[model samples]
Target: MSLRALPILFLFAAALTLTPISGLAAVGLAVGIAPPATVVETPPPPPPPPANVWAPGYWAWDGTKYVWVPGSYVVAPFPGAVWVAGHWVRGGHGWGWHDGHWR
Candidate 1:
């Protein structure tokens, strides 16, 4: 290739790499590499309640982001009550976490 054409080739390569492409409906694309993994942190235990069962804290999925809801004791949702721990689930190429509940 002649010197005059070298600059054009370089510009074309740059444009190709810089172009953006959308990925999954719930996720977006990154050029040349996948996105970094999200680190999930375990929350501290809730303060002791008056003769109440303890509920584990977990991350909750908001429409466009994740929010943390603190755990607390409350009246049982049903006659017989139990606490279910919250967990993060893999969805749409990302993690969708469900908050804990006391029932």
Candidate 2:
């Protein structure tokens, strides 16, 4: 591998691979390859407290191929914020990721 690419690889290998920060989503994650289709998931039953919102899963590029991230419920950031699930968008370079956030 080229020396320039070494650091990028090291970052993924050292830390958690393909995983986004908890609650916070990645703003601009561009990848050369396109991600696979999103998996179809039947959301599990909501917990007793209706405070939590369901965040649907999407394909995550792990510096390589796509990986499936299952869906789950998350507590709202604030009183009335809605969960905006992450998604993939096509751009000139390739597919890019727009992570979910509270509205």
Candidate 3:
């Protein structure tokens, strides 16, 4: 391959890798009817194992009804990373879920 073609190939590869990530973010941007607020009961936290952190559960829409996911301890994907709890936000049309991410 020519030297000039190498940069174009690298750019093409980068675009391909980032396409799926951008598409996933777009999918989460869909707005839907707001779900009723759920009152989550706090359960006593169990002893955490080494290098694990407690992830609080939240209500999720299952396309038919809201389901409560129980909280549990989750090991961090990488050192110094923290789990951000998911949340429902009010949008122009209704409500949407912002999935949690490690930061």
The number of the candidate with the highest lDDT is: 2
lDDT of 2 by residue, 1-103 (tens): 8999999989978787656774444456678887777788887764536787878888887666788989888888788888988888999878888877888
Candidate of highest TM-score: 2
Tell me the whole-model lDDT of each prediction, alpha carbons only. Answer: 0.54, 0.79, 0.75
- lDDT by residue for model 1 (1-103), tens: 8999999999999998876543233243212222234445454456545456656444444444555666555555665678777666655655544545665
Give the TM-score comparing model 2 with the true structure, all chains together.
0.67
lDDT score, candidate 2: 0.79
Q: What is the TM-score of each candidate against the true structure?
A: 0.37, 0.67, 0.60
Say which prediction, candidate 1 or candidate 3, comes out ahead on TM-score. Answer: 3
Ranked by lDDT from best down, the candidates are 2, 3, 1
Q: Supply every candidate's count of residue pairs whose N, Cα or C atoms clash at under 3 angstroms.
A: 0, 0, 0
Give candidate 1 regions above 4 Å deviation. 1-51, 77-80, 91-93, 97-103
Which is the better candidate, 1 or 3, if ranked by lDDT? 3
In terms of lDDT, model 3 sits at: 0.75
TM-score of candidate 1 on Cα atoms, chains taken together: 0.37
Count of clashing pairs, candidate 1? 0
